[model samples]
Structure formats: C-alpha cells, structure tokens
Target chain A: MAKMNMLQAINSALAIAMEENENACVFGEDVGAFGGVFRATSGLQEKFGKDRVFNTPLVEQGILGFANGLAAQGTLAIPEIQFADYIFPAFDQIVNETAKFRFRSGNEFNVGNLVIRTPYGGGIHGGLYHSQSPEAYFAHTPGLKLVFPRNAYQAKGLLAASLESNDPVIFFEPKRLYRASVGDVPEGKYTIPLGKAEIVQQGTDITLLAWGAQVEMLEKAAEMASKDGISCEIIDLRTVAPWDVETVSQSVIKTGRLVVSQEAPLTGGFASEIAATIQDECFLHLESPIERVCGLDTPYPLAHEKEYMADHLKVYEAIKRSINY
Target chain B: MAKLLNVDNPNNTSKNDTLNLEFVDEHALAIPTFKMLDDNGELYKDAQASSMDKETAIRIYETMRFIRVFDERMLAAQRQGRVSFYMQCLGEEAAVTGSAAALEDKDMIFAQYREQAALAYRGFTLEQFMHQNFSNEKDFGKGRQMPIHYGSKGLNYSTISSPLGTQIPQAAGYAYGQKLKGDKACTICYFGEGAASEGDFHAGLNMAAVHSAPTLFFARNNGYAISTPASEQFKGDGIAVRAVGYGMKALRVDGVDVLAVYEAVKKAREFAVENNAPVLIESIAYRLAAHSSSDDPTGYREKEEEETFRANCPIERFRRYMLKQGWLDEAEDEAAKEKIKADVLSALKVAEKVAKPALEEIVTDVYEDVPLHLQKQYEQLKQHILKYPEAYPATASRIEETK
Candidate 1:
C-alpha cells in the first residue's frame, strides 16, 4: 500500500482499466495529448493510440450523444465533461437517453459499459460557474449510477468497477481533492462495490453522514468535537445515488442522532433525501430531529465561498445542535 | 463565380441547346421515385413488386387494420380516463406498418414516440400495449417509464423516447456494431419531419455516411410536426434532399400509398446491405388526427386541413386497390374491422385488470444487481409509504406480497 492523491489514483485506475481492456477509451475537451485541463486523464494518449484517446469539439451534448453511440457499438467510453457545473447541456442525453436505454429498450440494445468522469464540488474557490455539486440532479434519474470518491483508494476502486460494469456511471471526482486527499491504494486491480458506505471513524454519540470533499471536513469536525467530549461517528457515503441506507440507518439507530452534510443547496440536495429517509426508517430510534448541514439554498456564492458552502465548522455546529436538543 | 461545365461534348453542342444540354453524368438528385402499382390497383408491367404472396399482403393489411382500430379505441379510452394519454396514426398507418413489414424480423427498430403502428405490426400484443400505456405489472419495461415508451426484448424493437432526434445517432452507432458482428440485420430508426430540425439528425446521417453503417433513416414527413408545418421546417425539397448533402442514397414516396412505401423500403434495405451504406427515405403524408390525445388541433390548425388528409387515408386507398384486384370482399372487410375492434377493447379490459409491477422493480435493472444505496432508498420509500398509507394505499398493501 502506498499513499496517493485523488489525481494519481484516477490516473492509475485509467491506466489499469485501459491495459486490461483494449476497448476502453477516454476523450474530452483537452484530454488527449495535453492530458486534460486538470490532468486527470494524464499520459493516456501516449500509452493508447490517438484513435482510442482524443479530443472532441466544445459541444457537451455532442460529446455525450456521440459517446452513447460509440458505447452502443462495443466501445467502453469514459468522456469527461470538464466540470460538473457545465454538464447541463448533456443532461438530457445522460439522464434521458443513456440512463433509460437499457430499461426502455428492454435490454435489446444497451450502452452497458460507459463512464462519464468529471470533477465536482467546492473548496478552492471555483465559484458558481465551476463549483456546483450536481450529483443530486442525476441521482433523481433511474438508469444511471452516481459515484463520488472521497480519497485515492476508493477513487481507484470505484473507477475500476465503473469501467468493468455493464452500466453507465457518472463518476464525480472532487476537484479540490484531486491533489489534496491521499490514501494508500493497492497497485493490483480491485473493485469496491457500488452503493456501499464506509465508516471512517467509530464513535457513539451521533452519526455524521458525508461524502466527497465533505468527508475531509467531517473528519476535521469530528476531531474538533472529540476534544469537546462530543464523540461523532463519521460515515462517508462514497456513492450518493442508490446510497447504502442500511448502514446509515443502523448507525443512526445506534447513535440515535443524525446530521447529514453536503456542499449542495439545502433544498432538494442529497442530504434532504438522507434526512427524510432517516426520519422515516428510524423515527422511533431518534433522540432528536434529523439535522442537515448543507450549502445555502442559493447559487454557490462567489464572494463568500466559505460561508455559503457547507464546511467543517458548519458540520460541527449542526452536530452540536442535534446533541444539545 | 463558379462556371457550369457542359459535359455533353462542348465542341459539338448546338448553341441553342448548349445551356440546357443533358450531361451523361452530372450531379443530380439520385433519389428513385417508385411506382409499382397504379392508382387503379393494377400491378405495373415495367416495375416488379416484392414477392409478397397473397397471404403475406393480407396479413400486412390485417396488421394495418389492427393498428387503425387500436389507435381509435385508445383515443376514445383516454377521453374516458381509461388511459391518460395517446398519439394516433389515423391517416399514416401505411407508412409505418408497410415499412415495418418490409424489414427482416431480427432487425432492430428505434422509434420516436408516435410510431405505434410499427410495434403493432411486429407482434406487440394488444394486452402488452394496454399494460404499457396503463403501466401494469405485465408490461415488460416495468412501470418506471412513461406511457408510450414501450420496449420489447423478445421483439428487437427499442423503447420509444420522447426526445425528438436522440435515436437517430444512436441507430448509427448500433448499426456500426451490427456491421462489426457481421450480422445481416440492420437497424431502422424512425422519426418525424420535426425531428429532422434537430442537430442529432445531421450528426447521425453524417456518421452513418462516414462509417458506411447499415441503417435506414425512415422520415415520417407528416405535413405537420405538432403544429409546425413542413414549409416552415425547411427550404430544401424535403428530408430526402438533405440526404444528398450527406452524400448518401435517398428516395421520397407517397406515404399514404402502402405499396409505394413497402417497395421503397425493400429496395432501400437491399441497397444498404449491398453497398454497406445508409439510405434516407422521406414518406410525405399528413396527420389526420391531432398530434396527441393531449393536443387540441382546433387552436393551431383547422378541421378543414384534417378533412383534406382524411380524404386520402392510407387504409381507404389500400382497400380500394385491394377490391379492384378482386382480393378483398366487402363482407370480409366488414368482418375483419369488427374483429379488430372487439379484440382491442377486450384486450384493454383484461390488461387494465392486471396488477401493477412489483415494488422491488424500482430498485432493479439500473445495474445487474441493485446496489446498497438503492436498497436503502427502497426501504426508506417503503417506510414512507407505510407512514402515508392514504397516499399510496395499493402500493402499501402490496409491499408484503412484493417482498
């Protein structure tokens, strides 16, 4: 095991998947010879020929639709959208066409193996245009699977699984953690089951559900709260859609308190669903109302990034409030 | 300015006829206009038709009649709240069923939302149709999809999507795969004239041309797209003209004439397989019915417009031709009509009585296995259903049975 950043893990995963399967190809705006804007698909074109890995036009809809066609024709496509906020133009293609093709066509024709990888979330001031957590928007869709990685180990595992699986996956890599977060990942090929939750730290006082960059913030908050004698159990929900509700519900029942966290708008955010589900399934087990520490219900503000977005302090406060109640 | 060259031997060409000289091989429209059977229902002496035996032609006619009756009854059912919505091909049945009849059964069909006639011709049972529209358990797609998005794996027809031209490019990609597999089967993607305005249509055609994929882009050029007329849609001759720009083969046929559509598609399919190329056929017809059960055509288009199209209905034209050929009897036609209507109504009754899809379906098929997160979501939804029993009484009561 060796410590590696999110970018290293993602790059490692791409290299492994491509080496294993000749059909796997990666394409995006600047993802070819130049690697990518963020270098996530770095060193791909040098390794695989340009036909398999190349640049596409600026049309987001074209990239997704064309990839769907390619994937349908026995190619494992991993197209990048550059950023999560700019993915709307391709939303109809991803949500309506890619997600529903298998179910709608009764599996007569399916775009079974495809991964749409892109960087998401806010920490290093990406502003409204570049730093929106758009996972919930796709989570509402039926056929597509949504996965976000909090660290390098899960990043490699989830990316590998996405490449191997016969389903379209939206792999949201947290932009800030592309270099910030690091962990020891096995050099050998591995796959973490999608829709599973991991418990980062064990505690008994309260359950803290978080994902992506927020997992780092949650760990920091849990550490801060530990000094104050509020032992918070931290659960990183790596995959948002089709979430591991059993693990979350069990934790909530044991702790008898829940605090959901995410860097998206409070209303209709993923945490809203988590809170509603916790209330419904573990209502009798709860010691207090399920509280959510989420980004403000507004466009991600430009001037006040730290205040507007949910972070370590906000999560710490939400947990304290739930405990005090 | 680019000079136009006289290819008919410029030195010997007479000055008077030079400007209008017919070149042996000049760039002109390559689309073949077909005429296999005449208006009086007489088979043409020069042009040979498909070897469709008497039995097969009659079977095709029966399927067309079935679709006509099914559309009419479903429209009436929607008005009575038996179904929520419907789109009918009241006048353009031939364009759909005829082309479908010409194809091999193993070929895949990617359809826009309005081509129920294709499904009906391909052996989609009336009960299956009703179950899909009503979202019953017996529906193969489960109840996850909206009404009219029917898909059947048993039959190679893809589920219809509401998006205008998504299937166009998808068909190209799917056909490319079929070519790789060395399958004789090709993919047929159907869309309307309105869908042609979308960028995906152009991309699909261009890709199909570039790759030489075996695909047929069947354009149902119904006079109107929703309420937008064909005149406003393009300044070109029609969709067939655009095919030439893509450097592909093309044709235009009288969609209301079932024989014409059948012959054009059959020839086009052969051309596609032989040359490993794509063919675009524009079938010019009119929608005598409104766009959908949800649409009120009276506001945008006039009833007089519908009257003009109703006069040239495909079924009526086919029936006239069949009678002239002495292949159809008035009493036999009347009996067939009665039987189709009875069949559709009884099928609807039985299908609607069937149970809704099991609750677990909500968590299945997104992947090979339902992941842990969706399982949690399902459990949560179940708990929510239990809490609000009145909101989903049937679902709540049926949860135990589903599990």
Candidate 2:
C-alpha cells in the first residue's frame, strides 16, 4: 500500500489501464500537456505518449461523439468532461448515442469500452457553473452505469472496476476530495465489486445512506448521532445506478428507520429513488417515515454556500428526528 | 448562439485580418460543381479519367441495382401493411455506392439512416436486409431499432442511428484510433445536407480538422432534407466550402455521376491517410422518392420537379455509361435485374414468416448481465402473462411452455 490522494489514486488507475491494454486511449479538453484542471490526469501524456493520451477541442458533445466512435472501433476510450456542469452539452451523445449503441445494434457495435470522467459537487468557491451534482440526470438512463468514488482507495478500485467492465460507465469524482481526502491505496491493480454497498458502521437505531462525498458526511453524522445514544448504520453506496438494493433493504429492515441524503436538490435527488425503493421493501418494519436531507430546489447560490449544503449537521438532525418519531 | 458547435456565417469565407469590418457578399463565392458525366452517360470535354476499372464498376452498378429493387419492393410492402416503415436512398444511390466502392472493406463506415446501398456494397445480403426491416428473430439487431437502421459487425458498418449528424464526430474518433495504431485504413462518415444543420455536424468537422485525424466526410446534398429544401438547410455554397473554415480539403461533385463520386472519394481517402487530415466531399443529387414511406411529397413538391430528377436516374446513368463502354451485355443486364427483384421478394416473404424474437430478448442486452431487480421484474412479468393468458395470447403461451 502507498499513500495517495483521490487524484493520485485515479492517475495510478489510468496508468495501469493504458499499460495493461494497448488499445486503451485517454483524451479530453486540456488533458494533454497540462493534465486536467484537478490534475487527475497528471503525467499521463508523458508516460503513455501523446497518441494514446491527448487533448481534444473544447466541445463536450464532440468528445463523447469521438469516444463513442473510438470505443466502437475496439479502443478503450476514456474521455473526461472538464466539469460536471459542462457535461450538459454532450447530453445527447451520452444519452442517445453512448447509452443506446450496444442495445440498438444488438451487440453488433458498442461504446461499452468507454468511460466518461468528470468532477462534481460543491465546497469549492466555484460559483454557479462549477459546483453542481448532475448524477441524478444520468441515473435516469438505463444503459449507463454510474460509479462514484468516496476517497483514495475507493477511487482507485472503482475506476479499475469501471475500466474492466463491459459496459459504458460515467465515473463522477468528488472534486472536494481530490486532495483533502487521502489514504493508503494499493500500488498495483485492484477492483472493488460494482453495485455493492459497503457498511461503514453497523447499528440498529437508524440507517444513514449516501454515495460519493456525501458518504464522508454521513460518517461524521453517525459519529455525532452516537453522542446522543442513537446508533446509526452508515452505508456507502459505491455504485449508484444498479445500486445495492439488497444491502440497503437489509439495513433498513434491521434498523426499522432510514435517512437518505445527497448534495443535489431534495425533490429530484437520487435520495428520493432510494427512499421509494427501500419503503417498498421494508414496509412491514415498524418505523417512522423515511427522511431525505438534501440541497434546496433552488439553483446552488454563491453567497449562501453554507446554507445550501445538506452537510453532517442536517444529516445528524434528520437522524434525531427519525429516532424520536 | 455562443455554443460549442456554432453556425458559421457562409459569407465569412476569408479571415478578416485587416482593421475595418465590412460584411462580405455571400454571392461573391460561387462553388462550381465538379461534373464528368452528363444525362446521356457521356463525359464532358477535357474531363479527367476515372480510376475505376471494368470489374469493380460492374460490382458497384449491381449493388445500386439491388438497392433500387429493395427500395421499390419494401415501399410496396409497407403500403401492403406487411412492414411497419421504409426509407429509400432512391436518387442518391451512386453517391453512397461509389464511396463504399472506393473504401477498403476494413475501413469503418458511420452512416445516417438512408445509406442502405453502402451496406449492400459491403456485402450485406438480401436475407440480412429482409431480417432487419421485418424485425424478426433472425435480425441481428433483435428488433430493437426501427426499420432502415441497419448495422453489421462483419461488414465493419456502424449501426445507423436516427439522430442526425451524431455519427460525424464518431467517425473522427474511429479514424484517430486507426491513425494511432499505424493502420492504413480510415473511417468514412455519411450524412445529408439536412443533417448538416445539427450542431453535431460542426462539432464533428471541427474536431476532425483540429486533431488532424484521418476521416472522410461524405455529404449527400440530395436537394431536400425531408420537406425542408437545401436552400433552407444552409446559405453556404453547399457543405463542401464549410471545410475551408476548419482547415480541411473539400470537393463539390455532381452526385448523379457514379464515376465522378468514385474518383473524388478515392483521392480524398488517400489524402486522409497520407497527410493524416480530414476531407469533405459534397455530392449534389436529388431525392427521387419521398423521405420515407410515411411522407407524401405531394404537398411540398410538384410532380414536374420529381420528373426532372427522375429523368437523370442514378442507376440509368451508370447503366448507360457501362453500355457505352461496351462493358455490359444487354441480355445479361435485363436477366440479372429480373432475378434480383424475384430474390428480394422471396427473402422478404421468408423473413416476415420467421417468428418474433423470444420474449426474453426484451430485457437481455441492456447490460452485460440482467441485474437482480430486472430479473425479478422479468419473473413478475411472466407470472402476470400466465395469469392473463387471454390478454397476451402470444407471449402467455410461450412463457407457459418455457416454464
């Protein structure tokens, strides 16, 4: 094991992917000599040469369109959108083309070998355009697999797994943890299983569910809730699309109460999906109504950054409300 | 629009390096269409020779003949309620088949929905065509895509997607992959003048030029994009001169002349691979048939206009050219067309009779493996079908027998 941050972990995984597979290519806007804005792709062009690791013109739709073509031509293409907010430009290519290529062709051709990487979520002083969680939009697409990593170790493992899978994936990295979050990640190749949730801490009073950077906040909330004598089971949902329904359902059944949280808005956040699915599975368990702690429906405001966040304090309060009811 | 793939001002051909800014006249630039063959299949004076030989010429003509047969019979089938829908490459045949003939079989092809002749040129048989249009069990696409959305792995043709210009940028990426691998092959992207209005067209061409990737862009300027005319599509001198803004090579050719298209693409293919750059070719033709079986051109265009285009039919032009060259036998040509029509009808009858794909196909290929929720849903659907056998008679019996 070696000490690495989230960006380092991702860089290591990309190096391994290029080394192991001769057909794999990495390209996006400013991904060449400059690496990425977050340095997630640092030193890739130097190590792999400019041909395999390159920069594309500044067009999100073009990047995905090119990636789809490359992947269909039997290359493992990893194209990065500079930011999650900018990914909206390529929505058609991702939603209509990349998502449907395999199914439409009946496996004759697929962009299944492509993985799109983009940094998401808030905490940086990045105003409207940079700080937004758009996972909820892509989650609605059926053919795609959305994978988000919480920290250094998970980042390396989940990225490796995504590269190895035979389906197109959207790997949303939490930019907030790019450097702040550090851990001892394995030096060589390793993969975490897709669509499985990890139980960070087991408890009986309530279940705290979240993915990506929100998992870290849930852990902090669980710690705060422990002081109040209410034990919380914290489940980090690694893969968000075909999520670990069994794991979440089992936890909700044992705890008899659930609190879902996310960085997106309360109405249409992925938390609503979790709540609806879990309620169906654990309806017989005697508990209060499920609670969702999330950002407000309004656009993420600049001056109201702190108030806009559904951080640990809000999650802790939700836990207390669930336990008392 | 301040978007990535912004529309270019057609009149702004030259860079305004000087200080004063006066809007240039769009009419100042007149792009001459490169024509070699006339309506009588006779070459113009001082025209250059085509690189096509006698043998390859016959194969291309045959593919065009087959597509004409396929389009006619399929449209008839749709009228008879035997098929759901159909689209024809009717007047644009020579443009598609000629380019397909020019490329190496290994080069990947990304096409819009109407280039069925390209697939036929790449050896897509009559049976495969029938299976896809009929959406039967034998269809390689498994009835997922609509009719005319054909794809073939063995033939190296990208599956046809309905969304316009989506394949343009993809062709750039695929060609870049080939360039990196030191492969001599390149990728060709085909779209119509109507699709050029899509942002993807600008995005795709810009990327291909910027990266210096070897991609051939084939634009069939077939006079109309459904009811919308080329005049409404763009105000430029066709789609060819737009390549100049992107620092790429381009050609505007008479699309009805099969030999001219063959020669232009052959030269463009060399430039793309040799220089590792992009090239665009605009083939000027006319849409002889309605956009699809669903469209009726009576309201949009007059019969006189259709008659004008039909007078210089793509297949007839090529047939006349071959007869003039003494390369085709009159009796053999007549007999071959008769046999082709019979073969297409036989294949259509057999493909339609084939059963629909197994019910499980509804959910099988969405992912590598069906997830737990999907599996449960599939099981529940079976139970519901069994409980209401009368309502879903076809699938209920199949599920019962399979269980």
Candidate 3:
C-alpha cells in the first residue's frame, strides 16, 4: 500500500484506468500538459499521448456533449469541467441528457459509461465561483450518480469504479482536500462499491455522518469531542447518489443520536437529507431530533472564510446540540 | 419570375444539361433541388427517378397523416394538462418525414426540438411517443426528459436536444466517425432556421466541410424564431446561402412538396456517402402552429397571417397532388387518418395510465452503479416521503403500494 495525497491518488487512478482501457480518454481545459488546473489529472497526457488525453476548447457544453456522443458511440470519455461552479454551462448535458440518457431512450441507447470528473468544494480561498459544492444541483437530477471521495484510498477506488461503470457519473473531488487528505491507497485496478459507506471510527454515543472535505472536518471535530468523552461514530458517504442508507441507518440506530455535517448551505443541502432520513428510520432509537451542522444559507461568502465553512467548531457545536437534545 | 443561379450541382460533379440557375456557378456552390415527381403529381422524364409504385406513395402519405394526427392529439393532451408541454411540427411534416424516407434505416439522425416527424417516419411506435410525452415507465426514456425530446437507438435517431444547433456539430463529428469506419451511413441533422443562428451551426457546417464528413444539415426555415421573424433573424436570403460560404453543397426546396424534399435528400444522402462531403438544405416553409403549447403566436404574428400559412398546409398540398395522380383516394386518406387517430389516442391513453418510473432510477444512471452518498440521498428522500406523508402524497402512496 502506497500512502499518497488525494490529488495524487486521483492522478494515479486516471493513469491506471487509461493504461488499462484504451477507450478511456480524458479531455478538458488545461487537463493535458498542465496536468489540470489542480494537478489531479497531471502527467496523464504525456503518459497516454495527446490523442488519448488532450485539452479541448473552453466550451464546457461542447466538451460534455462531445464526451456524451463519444461515450454513446462506445468510448469511456472522462471530461473535466475544471471546477464545480463552472459546470453550469454543461449542466443541461449532464442533467437533461447525460443523466437521463438511459431512461429517456427507454434503455434503447445508454451512455451510462461517461465520467465528468470535476474538482469541487470551498475552504480554499478560491472564492464564490471556483469553490462550490454543486453536488446538490446534480443530486437534484434523476439520472446522475454523484461521488465525493474524502481521501487517497477512496479517491483511487471510487474513481476507478466510476471509469468502469456503465452509467454516467459525476466524480467530484474536493479541491480543498486534494492535497490535505492522505491515506494508503492500494495499487492496481481496485474498485470500491459506489453506494457503500465507510465507517472511519467506531463510537457508542453519536453517529456523525459526512463526506468529502467535510469528512476531514468531522474527524477533527470527533477528536475534539473525544476529549470531552463523546465517542463519535464517523460515517464517510463517499458517493452522493444512491447513497448508503443501510450504513447510515445502522449507525444511527446504534448511536441513537445523529449529526449530519457538510460545507454546503444548510437549507436543502446534503446534510439536511441525511438528518431527515435518521428521523424516519431511527426515530424511536433517537435520543434527540437529528441535528445538522452545515454552512449558513447564503451564497458562499468571500472574506468570511472561517465563518462560512462547516469546520471543526460547527461540527462540535452540532454534536453538542444533538447530545443535549 | 426570379432569375435562379446557373452552376454545377455541388453535390454531384457529373456533367448534365440540368438548368444552370443564377445561384450556381462553375465552382459548384449551390445546392441542386431535384423533383422527378412534379407538383402536378406527374413523374417527369428523369432517368434517375426511382420506380415508386402506388403502395410506396400511399405509405408515405399515411406516415405524414399519422404524424399530423399524433401532433394534434399531443397538443390536446398538453391542453388537458395530461402532459406538461408540446411543440408541434404542424406545417413542416414533409421536411422531416421526406428526408427520413430518403435515407436508409441504418443512417443516424440528430434532431433539433421540432422534428418529431422524423421519429414517426422511422417507425418510432406511437406508444413510445405517448410514453415519452406522458413520461411513463414504459417510455424508453424512463420518464426522465421533457415532452417531445425523442431518442431511439433502434431507429438510429440520436435523441432530440433542446439546445439549438448542438446536434449540428455532434452530427458532423458522428459522421466523421462513420467516414473513418467507411460505413455506408450518413448523419442527417435537422434544425429550424432560428437554430442556424447559433455558433454551433457555423462550427458544425464548417467542420463537416473541412473534414469531408458525410452529413446533411437540414434547416427548416419556418420564418420565425418564437416571435423573431426571419427578416429580423438574418439579413441573408436564407440559411441555404451560408452553405456557399462554407464551400459545401447547398439547396433550397419547396418544403411543402414532399416529392421535391424526398428527391433532393435522396441524392444528398448519396453524395454524402460517396464523397464524404456535407450538404446544407434550406427548406422554405412556414410554421402553421404556435412555437409551442406555451407560446401565444397571436401576440407576435397576426391571425390572418397564420391563416394564410394554414391554407398552404403541407399535408393538404401533398394530399391534393397524390389524389390528382390517382395514387390516393378519399377512402384511403380517411381510413389512414382514422386508423392513426385511433392508434395515437389509444397509445396516449395507455401510456398516460402507466406508472411513472421508480424513484430509485433517479440515482441509478449517474454512475455505472449507485454511489454511497446518492444511496444516502435516496434514502433521505424515501425518509422524507415517509416522514412528511402530506407533503408528497403521490410519492407516499407509491411507497405504500411498494410496501
């Protein structure tokens, strides 16, 4: 097992997938030569050749639509939309067509095998446009599967599985944690099941559900809470669409109290959904109403970096609120 | 009479004494419109005209009737709120169905929003159309798309897109693939004249011309883009004129005349396959209906103006010519209409009644498999449905039934 950062792990996965499947091609602005704006797809163009891995014109819609056409015609096209916030130009392709391709064509035509690999999330000083968790927008659409990997191991495993999937996937890597999170990633063509949850730590008192950059935030909060005797059970939901209900349910049932956390806005955010589920599945088991600690309901604010993020303090606050309740 | 350009047929280099019009030159830029079966429903003394028996002519007419009837029924369904929205190609049937008829079944099509006639002509079942309109489980589209955006792999029709001209470039690229494979198939992309204004249109046409991809860029110049008429849309004569600038073959056809459209497209498809060259066809036509069910055409265009277009209806014109030829009679026309009306109505009823796709489908196609967070999100929605039964009563009822 080789220990590497999340960005390096993602790069390794892209390299391995392209090496294994001749059909697996990656295209985006600055993805080739420059590696990527974030270096997640770094060194791929040189390794795979420009024909296999290259840069495309800055038309997001064209990039995605071309990818869809290629994927439909039997190529595993993985397009990078550069940033999560900038994906709106290509939103229609993903939401209206790519997501719904299988269902819309009555399964007669399916490009269920394309991956839109994008770097998402705030916390880095990238500002409003560059740093957004637009997973909610994708989650709102029916046909799309959403993935948000936390660290190196999950990044490589989940991305490899996504590339191999016979469905269109939005593989969102947290830009903030691209270098921040590190873990041992097993080499070779390994795949993690898409809708499975990983229990990072066991706890007897409370279930802390989170993912992506927020999962790292939860770990820090959990460390802080442990000093005060709160055994926080942390569940990292690596995938967003078709998420692991069984894992979340079991954890909530065992812990009796649930605290969901995310860096996205509080209202209609990913955490709100998780908190709602706990209320339904383990309402009887709950010692409290499920509490959610999320980013404030506002456009991600600039100049208020610490105030905007659902960091350790917010996670700890939510845990306290759930415990007290 | 306007003096037409005289030049070589850009689509075909063969030296023939076809009338060289003003629009053409020795360089062969103009698109040659062919009509072996004249408007008088008489077959001209052309050696290239295919032998079309009464059966084939009747089949074509019946398909046109079916499409018109289906469009009318869908409009009614939309009015009843059984479906959300609809766009009817009421006056432009020949441009769609005729081109579809001219091609081999294996050839691919990339359509803009209004070319439902292509789907109908290609044997996309009435049930599939209804299912797509109503978004039922039986709908191959899985109740996921907005109404009228039809796609069928079996028919080789790339799904219709809402974005104007996006399919144009995509078709060119797809045709490039076909060229690379040395396949007999060419890609036919249909869009309205309004969509031709988008950059994708120029890009697609220029790319196809440069790459020598087998593609036919069919522009249905229906005279209006919602409220913006062609005069305001472009200063050029029509979309056909742009083909010359791209150094590709171009044509202008009496879009109402099904025979002209059919003959032109047949030769265009042939040229595309043989030389890997592209063709731009400007179909001169009018929109006899509102842009969509939501649009109020009376706000922009006069009722009398629309009345004039309705008078010169494509179906009516084609019907008259077909009847004059003694190929179609009153009885057959009525029978075809009655059968299509019944089929469309029955399919609509059946399709509307079918259940919507399961909620699990919402997350399934996003990846090769459902991811963890999405599973959680799915469960959360399920839980929300369970918890707040009053808010989503329909989903709650579905859940209860599933249980």
Best by lDDT: 2
- Give, for candidate 3 chain A, the lowest lDDT window spanning 10 residues: A298-307
Task: Look at candidate 1 and give me any clashing residue pairs.
Answer: A242-B373, A242-B374, A243-B373
Provide the lDDT at A99 for model 1.
Answer: 96
TM-score of each: 0.57, 0.57, 0.55
Where is model 3 chain B poorest over a 10-residue stretch in terms of lDDT? Answer: B25-34
lDDT of 3 by residue, A150-192 (tens): 8888889999989888878999988888887888887676999
For residues A253-281, what per-residue lDDT tens digits would candidate 1 score against the true structure? 89999989989877788899999888999
Model 2 ranges with Cα > 4 A deviation: A1-325, B1-22
Query: lDDT of candidate 3?
Result: 0.80
Error of 3 at B226 (Å): 1.1
Task: Rank the models by lDDT, top first.
Answer: 2, 1, 3
RMSD of each: 18.6, 20.5, 18.6
- Quote the lDDT for A127 in model 3: 41
